[model samples]
Target: MHIVAVGLNYRKAPVDIREKFTFSDESLPVALQQLKRTKSILECVILSTCNRTEIYAVVDQQQVCGHYIRSFLANWFQIEIGEFADYLTIYEDNEAIRHLFSVTAGLDSMVIGETQILGQVRNAFLLAQKHNATGTLFNMLFKQAITMAKKAHSETSIGENPVSVSYAAVELGKKIYGNFKNKNVMIIGAGKMSELTLKHLHANGVGKIVVANRTLQKAKELAGQFAGTFCSMGQLEEMLVEQDIDIVISSTGADGYVLTLEQMEPVMKKRKSKPLFMIDIAVPRDLDPRLMDMPNVYLYDIDDLEGIVESNLEQRKREAMKVDKLIEHELEMFHQWYRLLGVGPVIGALQEKANRIHQETMSNMLQKLPDLTEREIKVIRKLSKSMLTQMLHDPIMRIKELSAGRRGVEELDLIRELFALEDMLKEQARLPKDFLLESKPSESDDDRISPVNPVLA
Candidate 1:
């Protein structure tokens, strides 16, 4: 069996390209089912988010599964392969495991150390489990990754700082007001960025929120999330002046300033020189820079927040080093489990082969000594079985140890060849209905051995 991951992420694909491949919640189940239906794919999971769309699968080694995965994506999304293939990245086996671990740990995020991605990863895994898209390997792998992520967060400072721009904006707010509970906030737009900033503010217990946007419905929808008021863009100036808003967060798409000094001066004066903290996260500069010159007014732009984000990221990077060590340790544990899985059929085959030889030899000896009593025959059979077990114990232990090492798979292959256990192992797949009750292999069964079972050669 081979583990593979095929996807395009924020690092390799632009937003336009990434958006093209995004799988909505409604579409995810369909996509997962379709992917798993492919001939090479045995087990599958799909993780789709704003920044990436990744597919993880356990597949047959007889064919190049990566090619089939890419083709599946193209056909499912109705896009030409050449359109986004250049941006896709493929990781096989250990690399795929590492990629998933890094992603779950938030090391692969655009904002390093952000906690949201961990939740997103968990949700993706749960969705896959709910749809039955993930089988034994993914079930174990994803659970391990989540456990490691939890440990990383609890044992390290990786998720302790604010690394996102929205978070940095909140940090700035906290610095000025010392607390958000008493500060009234006015959001100048209802876009995703505004919603994110508002989420941070609400988490900090900010006072009443007022959302103003070009579309009153969008403003109301966003405001409803925080139990805040909503108003049209035309009412922004009036609301700002009348409500005595203390913090103004603007993230509008307007080409010009959304809040100019000319518009905010009177609002500031109406409050009798009360402090006003403004953050302009918009690209075209939502607030006039001249607003900074006004008394009791502090205005910061996107560039100002970037400096804090950079500093926070530097701290996160230091914490990430500790996370990397944790991941390394966890990876080895998973590899051990994986190797044990690979050696299971080998161990079963070896024991079966030994038991068969013991039974045959005992039968032949008994036939030549028909005068032996039933009790004596039973004694001989027991002694011979015990001796055979003792004889095979050391070699079995050695093979298990070797299988859990670097060249484990190679060692298992050698064991299968030396013991001539390949056919015996293959026969296991075709056992009769009462095979579990039967003492020996059946000759009539024709089922092929699972490719994942290493002893099948």
Candidate 2:
């Protein structure tokens, strides 16, 4: 069978397009079952997140797998093929494996090195497994992917740095105070940026939060979300001086600077020159630039935070190189297992045929020489089976080695031809019942590793 992945991510499609293809958690089991019933899909998993939606499948035909998956999406989501065809990207076999590994490791995420994608992949695999939509191949492949991601995170610093603007603000705070614990924060706006910054601060266990906005109701609404207190723009000066605010994040839509150096000078003096941190995230510059030059005043603008984000992004890129090497190693291991799967049925059929011939020969010799003692017949049967097993052992080992190497699918056919097992394979019922050619190959099946040689033991 062939492995295939077909999907559109944030890089390939906009939010609107990606959202249209998402699968709700409640619908995933039914969706997976339906996808598995498609002509080429034997096993399937759907990974649907806000940024991307993808389907990974094991299929009977590589050529038709993509078309069938697209059709499945079109029918299930009620979207036209033409509507999303341009956004779709399909990877087959090794490429499919590589893509999954990269995605699970967060290399393919819109935000590189983000850990959320790894959990999403794990959830997708688990959901598929719970629904019986995944078999041996996917079970192994996805487990490896999840394990690799965990390894990447633990072994590298890929996720250690902050890459978003709001996060950068927090990281800068860390540089000055190590952490925000027991520090009061005053957020100067009711905008989305202000809310996000407040969230990061609240999560860091800041002592107290005060939201200040020109509109008192808007400030109250934003503060209520985080269990923070609110103050009108007119009370900004009084709140700073009275509350001993340690951090000030300003992102107002006003045209002029909200806090000037002159305004903060008296406040800093009144607070006994205590350090004050401020972040100006507004487009028109809410916090005064000259305030940064004042003693005990730590101030940063959008440009400064963006620079930190860019630097952090570069650091993540460097770490991703290490993850790539890990991915390469996992891909090799997966291919090794896959190669053995291809040769398993052929080897099983060969052993089954050899046993049939050995049984017939032994029975005929025993019947022809009935005068021989029972002990003699038993000895002869044991010796005959041993000889056959000894002869098959070396060849079986060599075949396994070749299959696990760079040998292609055509080599399996050649091996079958040499053993004259072609006819036996065609007679499906006569083939060994243990050798399930269409289903997943068992790793514990002796024939997969040693063929008829195990009979000697």
Clashes of each: 0, 0
Compared with the true structure, all predictions reach lDDT values of 0.82, 0.81
For candidate 1, the TM-score is 0.73
What would the per-residue lDDT of candidate 1 be over residues 1-457, giving only the tens digit for each residue?
A: 8888899887788655775686767888888888879988888889886567899899986357877998998998899999888999999989899989999999988778877777778988898888888888999999999999999999999988667657878888888889998789999999877898999999999998999999999999999999999999888778987887999988876646777888877777778887888887665467888989998898887656645667778888999999999989988999888888868778778877877787678779988999999899878877877787777777777887899898888998999999999898889768774666765546412111212233333
Stretches of candidate 1 off by over 4 Å are 168-196, 202-208, 211-227, 230-308, 431-457
Which residue pairs clash in candidate 2?
Answer: none
Predicted structure with the largest TM-score when compared to the true one:
1
Error of 2 at 117 (Å): 1.0
Q: Candidates' TM-scores?
A: 0.73, 0.68
Q: Write the per-residue lDDT of candidate 2 for residues 1-457, one digit (tens) a residue.
A: 8899999876777645765686766788889889888897888889986567899999999888888899999999899999999999899989999999999998886557878778889999998999899998999999999999999999999887755456777767777788888889999999776887888888788888999999999999999999889999888888998888999988776756788878878788888888888887655567877998999888887556534556678889999999999999999988887777766667667777877787778679878987989788778867777777788777777777677777746677788888998787777556576655666755323222235432222
**Structural RMSD, model 2:** 10.7
- For candidate 2, report its TM-score: 0.68
Residue 129 CA displacement from its true place in model 2, Å: 0.6
For model 2, what is the alpha-carbon lDDT of residue 31?
A: 92
